[model samples]
Target: MDSDRIAEIIIAEIRSTVPELEAQPITRADSMADLGVDSIERSEVILATLEAIGLKVPMVQLHGPRNIGELADLLHAKSKA
Candidate 1:
């Protein structure tokens, strides 16, 4: 999938999982914490995003993407693999 589509999915998941973040504008540079996602909510978002895209990423691999853009790139790469 393209990065834009991946970003859309991530944003959608964030909106669904984090109620307070629903009205905020999320961007590539924004970290999960910046969207008011605590560690636990971060995990929930990650898992939900993975499930939404039908991808199974290792937890270790998931640790590296600190921002939405990076996470989208990672998911795009994994989806291709």
Candidate 2:
């Protein structure tokens, strides 16, 4: 239930799922548009991240986030709570 751990897992999952991201680190301020993350791809990343941590992420909550950083923050907060 740690924010930093969740962030780390998310970044790792993103890199694993999208091999093109092998060299870059996920950033909080980066937009999904800049990263070429479409809606479906974003969902894939989120789902992978949740699976990695043994969590069942709610699809309804997954609708709006655009990048791993924002999603990580939300998941981290939920974990903490």
Candidate 3:
């Protein structure tokens, strides 16, 4: 899938993992940290996103994205590989 779609998945996962943000608007430029998601919640979002995209990789390898867009881009690249 494309990065945009992956970003949507990430956003969905974020909303699902953190119900407090259900009414909040999420976009590609948003970061979980800035959204007030703790580290554990962030990991859960990422893992859930990965599962949604049928991706299996080391959690450490999924680091370095500063925002949802970057994470989607990285996940898209990895999925293509």
Candidate 4:
């Protein structure tokens, strides 16, 4: 899947993991922390997203993304790898 699709899944997982964001508008540039998602909730979102995409890797490998878009791009690259 492309980055945009991965981003969609990420957004869905974020909404599912954080109900308060259900009504909030999320975008590629949005950061989970900026959206009031706690670290635990962020981890949950990431794990759920990884499951959705069927991509398994070390949690450390998923770090360094500055935003959802970057995360999507990273996941897309990793999935292809």
lDDT for every model?
0.86, 0.69, 0.95, 0.95
RMSD of each: 1.1, 2.2, 0.5, 0.5
**Per-residue lDDT for 3-80 in model 1, tens only?**
778888888998898887888888988999877789898888888888988999786688888899998998888899
Q: Itemize residue pairs with steric clashes in candidate 4.
A: none
Which 10 consecutive residues of model 1 have the lowest summed lDDT? Answer: 57-66
**lDDT by residue (tens digit), candidate 2, 1-81:** 676677787767667767888898567666555776666766777788778777765778656655556777788766555
Cα displacement (Å) at residue 14, model 2: 1.4
User: Model 1: residues >4 Å from true position, as ranges?
Assistant: none
The deviation in Å at residue 59 for candidate 4 is 0.6
lDDT of 1 at 37: 88
Question: What's the distance in Å from true for residue 77, model 3?
Answer: 0.3
